[model samples]
Target: MSDLPVVVAARRTPIGTRSRAFAQVRAEQLAGPVLRATLADAGSATGRPLDVADVVLGNCMGPGGNPARVAALAAGLGVGVPGVTVDRQCGSGLAAVLDAVTAIRAGDDRPRLAGGVESASTAPTRSVDGVPYDRAPFAPAGWPDPDMVEAAEDLARADAITRERQDAHAARSHARARAARDAGRFDAEIVPVGGVLADDSVGRAEPLLPRLRPLFPGGTLTAGTATRISDGAAAVAVVPHRLRGGAAGLVVRGHAVVGCDPALPGIGAAPAVLAALDAAEVRTGDVAAVEIVEAFAAQSLAVLGRLGLADDDPRVCADGGALALGHPWGASGAVAMVRLFSRLVRAGAPAGTLGVAAASVGGGMGVAAVVEVVR
Candidate 1:
């Protein structure tokens, strides 16, 4: 395997709520702003204009053409930079990040700009239930389950997960999110878009709390605890090392992608993380933080439970999670990585401090990467 690239710059857009101003924005609109911000961040970090070797982007939906290419142009990027799009359902962003890292290690590219943007505002057709098909007949042969939530619910039942436990986990996510946001931890990786300064929304016009109580019946997972249907886009970037430090946060230590049974859908990420750790030759406890894509309350909790992690890891869904923060399919992974790296940078963690990012795909597939914060 090639050595991990030196990540020069990364930036993410402020997440917005469903039907908010960001809802009408195109991937070009979202991706362009962050790309410029990334280069700017790169210039400051390295004290020079980054010669981007490649661009890898993640987006679940957007204008038909290459949003990455459109973003490059919108950001005034030059032609020598080749770009590719990655889609793995909601996991595309992390996948793009891994692909970029893999390329850098293999000497295929240097100083690459890789990240993702998900414009839920422009999401293509999907079932009201978020399934990929309108009718049973439209399903593919041997198609695994289409809905992640349903599979998670099934996993809960099979594992005998109690509703009370699910509720508590959801609450913890919100409380941590509240604390993190209040503490400005999110500011590390977020760049305010050029045109917008603050987020104003109907669902998130205020803090998450009892007001969301009504959203989750039986108090199993309160709206305050769950991620909302928010519209937003975000990006992160990587490049080769001549090393000038931005914060010297992390080096891409090792990355691996593994497959698992698709029957349980979201549960696939569970094995994916384990496999990545084994592949990277790192132990679980050695990791300082873990960012598993929480598609649902149960799915998020399920992975931790399987790994024997209790509610408190100081690892956060702070700022909430997909249930509360909203899941813009394509941008979710990049957002998760941005959050993890930002947290590590703030804490001044050591090289031994490892972080994991995982996401689930339709038809029971899951993918993830392991990053070591190389200070």
Candidate 2:
């Protein structure tokens, strides 16, 4: 029996713009349905009832008292399964999945559920010393800590990414997402929530993109070129490869997490991807699919350039990304992995087809995983 972890099922809630369809939903509420659906899918694939050993979830700005435990209980997983929450900012979801992979590699063969959830609409306001603050500092004092928007603007200037290019990229993302949705390409992986069956943020933005003003003075980034604040959840079921029962799935190969200069946080994914590919003994040209979180068009373009990919590479985000689907912070990374699964395993890609999922985190860090289709 192969000891490697294999993802047999993946699902996500329809992403909603902040203060919109999911405004009344809590973090655990958003996560519960997807967890239940993922477990059922995994059970159907393996043709046996799974004794889930644990539940691992990631979150950013939700009311915290171990949300993962609450979600597991809410999903009716029984009281026997223990749960743990992970926080790596934007990389939380993928990191949680990697944690499960680590456990399976350590000889614990029990099935595990791992993913991330975020409720931007219902996130509690925080205070420090009686003064309210929007978010905690990403870096400690004496470090270059810039707001994400500001960092994107700085990266645009440094990389000489033109305004026209950013606008075009964002427009392309929206068009692709719209086309995919229309063709029902997203139906298989989405679990309807809050009466929303489809992502609300994908729209025709080309006309409005060029009309928007720069977010910062003398900067190229505009609201149209940046991902919207959103609420959503995504989860996947992982089990030992021996239990796959000849079913199609993603076999976990290698993963890496690395940090870069805080000032150029948007470029962090480049090194992490390189390291992950090296660990898997795969080359850049050999990957059949890639999904990198699209927090900002300029930031994504910069990372792709560093990785020696063209600005409009078809292999990357073939059906669009966060810029069109919306960014739910911690859940975005897991969403990327789910996208890779749908594009490869669900689409009938042959065995041994390689794919990559990655995200450039807010605090100068990157997380990436290499997976291959197997039967």
Candidate 3:
């Protein structure tokens, strides 16, 4: 245990709908406060101020400057700690977490702050060679690099996922999230941001599911089934197990990142999950909880099928998912981590409970990790 790495604290801001509660907040502004809060929590829990060696944050469409450095400075972490910004698209946040664990595993032993942040409302317009575009090119010319929604539509057609199923799944997500919010289940992990104590994007809107139209012609991926753009930030405090003191959290067991057909990016999570589970020496049945980003209902359903899980598997996103909470792009993966922390630590999940966090990336990639709750 002394040689392993463990999460000491995890916290995330209330997810804000795009152009709504967090429209005016910068990416750094969102991340810095969460980082500070996470550090404060970790410090109190461990009975000492954390000596974080570095800070790593993920961002997608934020400004060109290094947002992680800006966030660390904004958090008043001082000039001693450096920062790195990761850009693995949707997987960036989880990848940042894995990077911190990797550093700890390689004998660094020092604490590190890792998570993600996104400010979709304030994201700068991206362009290729000065030609304004909605997103930067992910693949070279002549390769099938359809937009994410188109890729989800492809998955839906290939996997025979219907609009009905997608809508049903989205509705279930909303109901579960609303129930959790009403029960105050999220209070332990969510840190207030901009005076928002609960996820502002979640609401009772199951009736609106059928009314929303698809992004493409005759496509099944509708606005109600897919996650909308959102703004948020999340932070995790990671340290060697020897330094964890008495705090109970998830022990870093294993991780994997895998690539897939860029044309069907939605299927990436399945393989990544399998690989990570194999590395962790655990089977799907051994997992007590799961958190997979709901990039789209079609893709999420496809991943579930590939992983041999039912659409409503009790172990998968049991509380809710991106479809209900909103997708803050780079921040979502870390949000998944925070969710795991809530379930395995704050919720008093039994010791040795296995949990997994996974996400499908924009460029036909996926990232996954396996963790075990420890006391």
Candidate 4:
């Protein structure tokens, strides 16, 4: 417990719209540069050469062949540095960070880089024997296995989340994101990608959000309220607490991954957050900030309402979320952590300030982690 890990540096590529600037860029292409840039940032910020022992990344759709290892070499991390990848759908990136934290807690003191990348523009069309398919089922036989959009609708129905509420939340997301971008809050951590310096998806969607129709019949969610498919990559440098040195940092306190009803996957993040906070011996009120992936405005609202939090909870996504920034599938989870890093660590929040990063998976699972600002 005393040897918990801490993030020394974090960086991510500017998220690109689907089939736009990053259409030709592969997942490895987005990941490799961010990996190299994170290491460089750590070294330059800490004023010391940090040796990375492993590179662990999360990927949902990349040509199947250990993309982490490929990205490691591409980033010039060397053939000696070990690499591994995890797949948990949308939660993959945060899960990767949890795995690294676990490894370090078990006594591996070497520095490691963990995050995720997604290039939806470049993801290959999956097929079975030449028949095109959208996605594989999340549940087994006799289990409810609805596609993501359907699951979100189910969750909205179950939680009584209204279209008006969803639109309001999404509009708020965009407004906050645009304000943050305008203030240059994102510039410090966003690495240039495909010649773009800022996230291209963020805008003032409030005025137009309420006019958008539902994505599915009888559903409350709309394209304006749901996250956009995007291309981006994010990585963070983690080391043993004793070795941590940087601007200001976050210490890994606790983490949990829990399962829920696959038919209503959007609600998974709440249970995961409860489990993680319990594991860390902290209460919701204790956390100074929160980052729950906004897969859909309905899903996010469901989580907040179930947790007894308001949609406008100041602690959650104070600078906006996936609804505004766009969701790069695997990369969105790490992007949440990067947001928390920017607010609590880089911005120099008071000592002992607690923050959480959490996301729901496609397979009815949720990954949540707790961190403390080391002021």
Candidate 5:
């Protein structure tokens, strides 16, 4: 591991529509290619897994217990390389990345494989998933009751997330995202996978903005404003180095994971970020950018208000966020990280680039991560 963990490379796949049944195969099938490409894009061996530390990953859906382990082995990672799979619901991807950073910064391990892979194609929608509040006998013990959207509505009512404010936020997302898509800001980060219906690579590289219709007439959040359920996976490789001359190396500095009540889902990330920022001793102002997953238009607005981030700030996902792009659950974290790293490189500002990615699961289960891009 470098004296400090620098993000040598980052890559993400386009958000996918699983139920749309676009003839796309399984989740792992998609994750494999992106995994290889991420390594290659970094000038590292994409196919040849590194010999450094461990493999860490997170996923929301089941069917693949220890997904990180399975993904690592399936994608040709080193044999016997310890693999860990964590479930932080929406924050699964960030959680996985953080786990690797924590291990390295704590000196428990160095040069580890840290990233997240999520495929909505593998799991059922929250409606059919029997997620506690949706039904009884919650087979998935960790799956809390009450859907994330319901929780967001509740929060908005209590916190005064005005419909107008939410609508304005959603509109800005579409406008800004469309602009970013036009400008090619996401070029360096997005990985073009095989199965794509859109002629352009990044899904929204070609605008479908004309079709911004909502099922409800006066809906506060329109289809243009919310994150779409998508299918895809993303991964990044991290290595350690011993910088000579007492220099702080360009490596991932560290990461943190915090626990909070699952009932309030969207706002759950506040505690996690506080703990992470404390461990890194970094402040929000010092952060160059944040990639908070936009689960819903209202959800994102609520989280931003709580975090005190300016909605129009250039530092937060300079390239359109999940609302404009899409939120593919497991795939979204990698997507945010990939874009954040690219922006950091272009800005050349922070020695330690910080990225914040948040997600909301049913109940109050929210996950957050703070990653530093060194080099």
Candidate 6:
């Protein structure tokens, strides 16, 4: 049996724009259904119920009670299946999946379910002292901790990513997403939740992108060029390659989490992707597919440019990305992996086909994973 960890199933709930389709759903409620669906799909693929060793999840902005355990119980995985939650801001989900992969590679043969969830609409209001705050500071007082938007704006200026280019990139994302959704390319990976059968944000941004004003004065980014705040959950089932039973799946190749200058946090994924690819002994041109969390058009373009990929490279987010699908913070990273699984595994790519999933984190960090298709 190969010691490599293989992902046999991937699933996600329809992404709902904040204060819309999933306004009343809690984080665990959002994660539970996807977890159940992913597990069932894995069981179907393997022809037996897996002895799941753990349930690991990434979350941000939820009520802090170890949401992973709550979500696990909610999925009826039984009390015996312990759960752990991780937080690396937007990169949490992919970090969780990599944690599971590390465990499996370290001689733990039992299967595991890992992913991320977020319910921005239902998150509790937080306060420090007598003042309310949207979120905790990503860096301490001595460190440069600009808001994510501000960081994106700085990155755009530094990279000379213009407003016209950003708008075009966003438009392309929406068009690709709408076309993929229309063709049912996203159907098999989406698990309906909160009565929301499909992503509510797709196909709504392309036409308005060019007309929208910049989010900040004299900035390249606009509301249309940024990912919508959303509610969603995404998960994948991981097990030893031996248990895959010759089924098609993603074989874990390499992963990395690296940090960069805090002031330009949005470009962090570039270094992480390079590191992961180097670890996997693969080059950017060798990758068949790539998925990076599209927090903002300028940010994504900067990352791609750093990695020597063209802005319109079809290999990157071929079916659109967070710009159209919505950004459910913690879930977006895991969502990237799920997208890769769909494009590579579900679409019947040849064995050894390479793919990459990556996300820029809030505190000047990036997380990325390299995976290969195996049958």
Highest lDDT model number: 6
Candidate 1 structure quality by residue, lDDT tens digits, 156-234: 6767776666666666665566666677776667767646543333234235444454332433434444456555666
Lowest lDDT sum, 10 consecutive residues, model 3, at 197-206
Q: Considering TM-score, which of the candidate structures 1 and 5 is the better prediction for this target?
A: 1
Please write out the lDDT profile of model 4 over residues 1-375, one tens digit for every residue.
346788878899998878987999998899999999899977876677888989989999878688888899999988899899989999999988888888888888888999999999988899989999877778989999998888888888888888988888998898889999999999888988768888888884667887888888777888888888899999998878767654467887878999998888988899999999999999999999999999999999988887789889988999989999889998888988888889887888987999999999997999899999874
What's every prediction's RMSD, in angstroms? 3.9, 1.0, 1.1, 1.3, 4.7, 0.8
Worst 10 residues of 1 by lDDT: 197-206
Model 6 lDDT vs. the true structure?
Answer: 0.93
Using all chains and alpha carbons, the TM-scores for the candidates as numbered come to 0.86, 0.99, 0.98, 0.97, 0.80, 0.99
For candidate 2, list the clashing residue pairs, or say none.
none
Candidate achieving higher lDDT, 1 or 4: 4
- lDDT of each residue in 200-318, candidate 2, tens digit only: 88984557998999988888999999999999999999998777776678987889999998888898888999999999999999999999999999999999999999988999999
Could you tell me the TM-score of candidate 2? 0.99
- Clash counts per candidate, in order, are 13, 0, 0, 0, 20, 0
- Candidate lDDT scores, in order, read 0.68, 0.91, 0.90, 0.87, 0.59, 0.93
Q: What is the full ranking by TM-score, best candidate first? A: 6, 2, 3, 4, 1, 5
Residue-level lDDT tens digits of model 5 in 192-301: 66655221223342254345554355444445445666676667665544411222223444345555555566776666666667766788887777777777767777
Candidate 4: what lDDT?
0.87
- In model 6, the worst 10-residue window by lDDT is 239-248
Q: Residue 276 in model 5: shift from native, Å?
A: 2.5
Candidate 6 per-residue lDDT over residues 158-187, each given as its tens digit = 989999999999999999999999999999
Task: Tell how far residue 69 is off in model 3, in angstroms.
Answer: 0.9
Cα shift from native, residue 213, model 5 (Å): 8.9
Worst 10 residues of 5 by lDDT: 241-250
lDDT over C-alpha atoms for residue 243 of model 1: 42
